[model samples]
Target: MIISTRRIKQWLTFLILFVLFTLLLYQVMSFFTDMFEPDSIYKEPIGDAVKVFSDYGRQTSQATFSELVRERLLWFYEIGE
Candidate 1:
């Protein structure tokens, strides 16, 4: 099998752009999460997602997405109560 140089270059460019885009998106989401209070539905989910990501990095045990969502929701309800 033979691949063209131009095709390889295009694939590399696409990979780089995809990585940069993902990083930018994560930063933007994190910024909004930090900026907003967990008072409304929109803001709360963002904050929770940030917290979950942070926790995943910090802890020895890995948390599943469902577990993180459940824990965050429980916390939110407890705060409301």
Candidate 2:
């Protein structure tokens, strides 16, 4: 039997809807996983700001501007590590 255009369109629609639904489900699962996972880096920032800079040796005033900025970001990342 020859497949009709309507039959092909129906199957294609089903496929797209299935893919979209699966993607949404996966995203939701990931969101929950990240939210509840221990040691997840998506945590609130802590520690003193000045301490973070000093810990990076920025208190010496010898670090360049770019180096200081990079170190500051590194400090933020280190909090959750």
Candidate 3:
């Protein structure tokens, strides 16, 4: 039940190379899969992966971009009713 030093070195090298090869294969496969993904990928951007920016502060009143522009325009016009 005794192993030779050369045999142990061979097994170690094999294990290391096997692990590296598996990692390489996984990366190649994932690259291909991502390349072939549907264009609708962006349609689900706010999915479970990222939900922070989509639903921001709730307690504070926030004016949208168009509303802010309109308010600025009215202020500049000085329309008093």
Candidate 4:
């Protein structure tokens, strides 16, 4: 089969369109699904940011970060026995 340059260009265009269409469909589905569940359980950015800084500080100082962090979390959640 002798494939012409025009046919090759058309095939390339179709491949590009198919890929773009698939990406757009995926984005639309994700947007709708996220809107339905707007509130996420693990969405505490402020608290998480503070925790990351605290962990970094403890690691640099060679201190028992886990013990202190556990105590702090326990106090925050009132999970004392």
Pick the lDDT winner: 2
Query: Candidates 2 and 4: which is better by lDDT?
Result: 2
Give lDDT: candidate 4, residue 9.
100
Taking all chains together, the TM-score of candidate 4 against the true structure is 0.45
In model 3, which regions exceed 4 Å deviation? 41-81
lDDT of 2 by residue, 1-81 (tens): 898999999999999999999999999999999889889566766776343234544366777777887877797799953
lDDT of 1 at 55: 45
Candidate 4 per-residue lDDT, tens place, 1-81, comes to 898999999999999999999999999999999889858678777543545444345365655767777778888789563
The residue pairs in collision within model 2 are: none
**Residue pairs in clash, model 4:** none
Error of 2 at 55 (Å): 32
Which digits, one per residue and each the tens of the lDDT, describe model 1 over residues 1-81? 998999999999999999999999999999998888556655445333544346455666678767877998898899973
Every model's TM-score? 0.45, 0.47, 0.48, 0.45
Listed per candidate, the RMSD to the true structure in angstroms reads 16.1, 8.7, 14.1, 9.5
For candidate 1, the per-residue lDDT at 53 reads 47
Candidate 1 worst ten-residue window by lDDT: 43-52
TM-score of 2: 0.47
Collision count for each candidate, in order: 0, 0, 0, 0
lDDT of 2 at 26: 100
Residue pairs in candidate 1 whose N, alpha carbon or C atoms collide under 3 angstroms: none
